[model samples]
Target: MQVLLASPRGFCAGVNMAIDSLELALKAFGAPIYVYHEIVHNRHVVEHFQERGVVFLEELEEAPTGSTLLFSAHGVSPEVRQKAKERDLRAIDATCPLVTKVHLEAIKYAKEGRTIVLIGHEGHDEVIGTMGEAPEAILLVESPEDVDALEIAHPEHMAYLTQTTLSVDDTSRIIARLRERFPLIAGPTKSDICYATQNRQEAVAKLSADADLTLVLGSQNSSNSQRLAELSKEHGVAAYLIDGPQDLKPEWFEGVETVLVTAGASAPETVVEAVLDYLKEHYDAKIEPRLVREENVSFPLPRELRQLASS
Candidate 1:
């Protein structure tokens, strides 16, 4: 068996920074560093941190007053930040810069008196945070159909923003429809979708053709990871989204000549290696590394974290 291990497959810049922040906090401040969310969507990463005394909290009240709390990469609403402040918790932001861009866009459009249509799945952490920026001014839409059904209070004063981790093709279609109805929409393209999401999907869309089956390394709740698997299946290849090697089934490899393996941005590279090793040991698979695009983006640790570190 031949394994096509994709390049740029795991741990994008934002994930790297978020994980680094957690590790640094744990090292400098000792165990029991409080985090507002999973830090990223990966179960393995969260579990690893949890074992080290990193407490993940869903509610601000759960954290003790004056505890150090880190926000997840998905970002959090300003409301959450205010509550943390009220609780006197020292909050460390780990929000990806790309997601922050969408939140800022929503704020800009809302302040201009424009109704913003956010192109993203409902309940997603990133979407929830951005919508919080201008909840009254923003409406959520998942498809072009949603665009057609929208009755904007002021059609001429409309704009759009998107979750950074969405499929480029899906967002493009929705943006097109929004343009047809609201020609003056503030954001006319899917530029809000992050580069990592677009690159990974493009790689899978291009390489899945040669593989009999494609395995995506990511958690169920990871939006970008889900898109990679769904995008592969759309290209007519069988794809499975698994958290790690343990999720791989023998049936998926039956009669499969070539297997394409890719990891989501939030997924750890160690999981990818373990999955590859499982295939190599069990099936005597040969690894073939394929890099679709090169990425060199990096975000520094949050300013607050840096200040804390210096002090």
Candidate 2:
């Protein structure tokens, strides 16, 4: 079997910044760091931090007063920040700058009294947070069909925003539908989808077209990871979203000549390497590096955390 490895896969700048911030918090502060949610949506990444005494909480009230709390990369609502202040907890924001940009755009459009159409999966952490910015003003739409179903309060005054991690092609279709219905809809100055998500999806889409199968290394709850797997299937290849090699089944590889292995933005590269090792041992797979694009993006740590490190 031949293994086609997708370059620009696994940890992106946002994930790297989030993980690094958490690690520095551990060293600067002590164990038992209270994080609002999993720093990033990878099982392996969360488990590794849990072993180091990080506590993941779903609500601000769950954390003890005065404890240090960090927001996950999937930025939190302003209400969450206010609650943290009320609880007297030291808060460190680990939100990706790209996600933050969407939040800001939501605030901007809401203040303009425009009916904001937010394109994202319902109940997703990032979507939830972005909606919280203007619950009264924002309407969540997931599909092009949903866009058709929208009943804008004022057709002439409307804007749209999207979750940073979304299928570029799907989002474009949804946006087209929105424009078809509301020809006057406004949008952000640039696309809301981050560069890393676009690059990884493009790599997998290109590789999966030629490979017999595609294995996406990520957890089930990971939205971007799920999209990568879905994107592969859309490209006419069978794809599986697996956390690690342990999830791999021999039966799936039957009659497969080549496999495309890629990882999501939040997935650790070590998991990818482990999957490669398994493929080599079981199928004697020969690996080939397939590069669709080059990614060289980096984000700075949250200012509070940086000061903590310096202090």
Candidate 3:
């Protein structure tokens, strides 16, 4: 068996920043730190922090009053922030800057009286957060079909933004549908899909063309990981999105000669290694890396963490 690894496979700048923020907060503020959600969608990352005494809470009410609370990289809505404030908890935002950019764009467009169409999955933390910016003005569209059913009051004054992690091809199709329906609709200066998501998906797409099968390393709840798996499937290749080696099924490798392995932006490199090791041990696999892109992006820690580290 041959294993092809995708370059730029795991841990994007946003995930790195979010994890680092928690580490720094622990170093500066000590144990019992509360994070609003899994800092990223990967369970391994969250479990690692749990071992270090970081408390992950889904509800603001669960967080103790006045405890230091950190938001996840997925970003949070104004209502969440207001809830935090009402709880009188000290908070630090760990939202990806790219996600923040979309939120800001929503605000700007809404203030300009433009109807905003958010292209993303419903109920996603990032979408919820972005929608909170201008709830009344923003419309959520998940697919080209949704765009067809959309009813906007002012078609001439409209704009669209997308979640950071989305299938590039699917997003493009939706955007096309939006344009066809609203000729004067505006959009972000740059595509809202972040560099990491774009690079990872591109890598998988390229690798899947050559391999017999593709394995996307990520949790089920991870949007980016799910997209990678779907991308491969769309190309008529068999793909699996597994959290780690534990989820690997021996039957998946039946008559499979080559496997392309990749992880989502939030997945860790260690999980990739574990999967590779599992394949090698079981099937005597030979590993090769498929280089699709060189990612050099890094986001700095939050200002509060920076000051603490410097001090």
Candidate 4:
């Protein structure tokens, strides 16, 4: 068996920043640190932090009052921030700037009385946060059918934004449907889908063409990882989204000759290498990295962390 690895697969700038924020917070403030959610969507990353005394909470209420609290990379709604403030918890925001940009757009468009259409998965943390920016003004649309059923007060005065981690092809189709239904719909001058998501998906699409099976290393709750698996399936290839090599099944590769391996933006490359090492030992596989794109993006740690480090 041969393993084809996808290039540009694993930790994006946002994930990198989010993870660093937590580590720096731990270093500066000491342990028992509370993170509002998984800093990034990778299980190994979250577990690593858990082992280091970082507490992951699903709600603000879970955080002890007056404790240092950090928001995850997925961003949080205004309500969550308000609750944090009410509780007097020290807060550090680690939201990806790109996600914050979409939230700002939702706010601006809503203030202008434009009905905002959000293109994203309905329950995704990012979507929930973005929608909360202008819930009254925003409607979530997951597909063309949802767009068709959408009823807005004024179609002419409307705009759209998307979650940062959507599939490029799926988003384009939904955007096209929105444009067709409302010829004057306004949207981002550029795509809302982040560059990391686009590059990773493109890499998977390119690699899945000739591979016998595709394995995506990521958590089940990760939207981007799920999308990579879906992209592979779209190409008529067998694909599985696994958190790590432990989730791998020997039967999955029973008749497979070539396997394509990729990881979500939040996934660690070491996990992928571990999976590859397992495959090499078990299946006598040869590995080749399939480069589709090169990424040079890097995001700095939060201002507070930077100051503390410099101090």
Candidate 5:
């Protein structure tokens, strides 16, 4: 069996910044640090932090008064920030810069009296945060069907934004549908999907074409990882999104000869290696590293952490 390992698979700049901010906070602020949400979407990452005395809270009120709070990489709405401020929780924002950019775009469009159409899945952390920027002015559309059913008061004065983790090809199609319906719909000059998401999807598209099976190392709740598996299935290949080697089933590899291995942005490379090791022990798989593109992106730590470091 042959294993095709993706090069730009795990720990993109945003996830790195979020995870690092948490670690730095733990070191500087002592244990029982409160994070507004999972530092990243991967279970392994969250579990690791939990073991290190980091507490993940879904609500701002859950954190004790004066506790240090770190926002997740998914970003938060201005309302969330306001609430955090009101609660007097010492806060560190770990939002991905790209996600922040989308929020800014939404604010800009709304300020111009344009209704905002967001292209993303409903209830996703990123989508929720972006929508909160202009709740009354923003409309959510997950597909072309949603666009067709949309009732806009001012189609002429509308702009579109997208979640950073969306499938590039799917988003393009949805954007086309929006444009067809509203000829004057405005949007960012470039797509809102993040570079890391785009690169991984492109690599998986290539991998799915050449491999009999595709294995994506990531948590089930991870939006980007689920997209990778979906893309492989779209290419007519059997794909599984697993958290780690423990989730791997031998039945999946029974007739599979060539397997493509990749991880989501939040997944750790060590987990990928564990999966590979399992494959090697069982099938004696030959590893072949596939480099679709070289990623050199990096994001700075949160402002609070920087200030803490300097102080």
Candidate 6:
């Protein structure tokens, strides 16, 4: 068996910054540090932090008064921030800057009296956060069909935004359908999908074309990982999004000569290596790195952490 590894896979700048912020917080403040959600969507990453005494909560009230809290990389709405403030909790925001950009765009468009059409899966953390920015003004749509079904109160005054982690190809198709339906719809000055998501999807699309099978290392809740798997199948290749080697089944390798391995932006490289090690032990897999592009993007730590360090 031959294994093709995708370059620029695993741990994007946003994820790195989020995780590093948590680590530093833990070191400085000690255990029982509360995070609003999984620091990232990867199960392994979350579990590792949980073992280290990081508490993951879905509700703000669950946190003790005056306790330190870290927001997930997915970002949160202004209401969440206000609620945290009401509770007097010390908070560190770990939202990806790109996601924050979309939120800001939402605020700008809504302030302009434009009904916002958000292109993303409904209820996704990032989508929810972006929508919450202008809930009264934002209408959520997941597909071209959804766009067709939309009946806006003000068609003449509308704009569109998207989840930061979405399939680049699918989002483009949706955008086209949206423009066709609402000929005057305005979009962001720049794309809402972040650079890491676009680059990873492109790399996987190319790899899937040549490889017989593609394995994406990420959790089911991970939006970008799901897109990578879907894109592979779209290219007429079989793909699986697995958390780690534990999820791998021997049946997947049957009659497969070339396998492409890639990881989502939030996934750790260690998980990818574990999968590779499993294949090596079971199938004597020969590994070859398939570099489609080079990624050097880096994001700074949360402002609170930076200030703490400087102080």
lDDT by residue for model 5 (1-311), tens: 99999888999999988988888899998999998878889999989989989999998999998889988999999999999899999899999999999999999998999999999999999999999999999999999999999998878999999999988889999999999999999999887899999999999998778899999999999999999999999999999999999999888988898999999998999999999999999899999999999999999888778877677
lDDT on C-alpha atoms for all candidate structures: 0.91, 0.94, 0.93, 0.92, 0.92, 0.93
Displacement of residue 209 (Cα, Å) in model 1 is 1.2
The deviation in Å at residue 104 for candidate 5 is 0.4
* Cα-based RMSD of candidate 1: 1.4
TM-score of 4: 0.98
lDDT of residue 87 for candidate 3: 96
The residue ranges of model 2 lying beyond 4 angstroms of the native Cα positions read none
- What's the lDDT of the predicted structure labeled candidate 1? 0.91
TM-score for each model: 0.97, 0.99, 0.98, 0.98, 0.98, 0.98
| Error in Å for residue 75 of model 1 | 0.8
Residue pairs with clashing backbones, model 6:
none
Worst 10 residues of 2 by lDDT: 302-311
Candidate with the larger lDDT of 1 and 4: 4
| lDDT (Cα, tens digit) per residue for candidate 4, span 226-253 | 9999999999999999987789998898
Which clashing pairs does model 3 show?
A: none
Regions of model 5 farther than 4 Å from truth: 307-311
Clashes of each: 0, 0, 0, 0, 0, 0
lDDT of 1 by residue, 1-311 (tens): 99999887889999999999998888878878999878999999999999999999988899999999999999999999999999998888999998888888888899999999999999998888999998899899999899889987778898888899999898889989998899877883448889899899989998999899999999999999999999998999999999988998898889999999999999998999999999999999999999889999999899877875676
Q: Kindly list the per-residue Cα lDDT of model 2 for residues 1-311, writing each as its tens digit.
A: 99999999999999999999999999988999999988999999999999999999997899999999999999999999999999999999999999999999999999999999999999899999999999999999999889888877689999999998999999999999999999999999899999999999999877887898999999999999999999999999999999999999999999999999999999999999999999999999999999899988999999998776677
How high a TM-score does candidate 6 get? 0.98
lDDT winner, 1 or 3:
3
Overlapping backbone residue pairs in candidate 1 total: 0
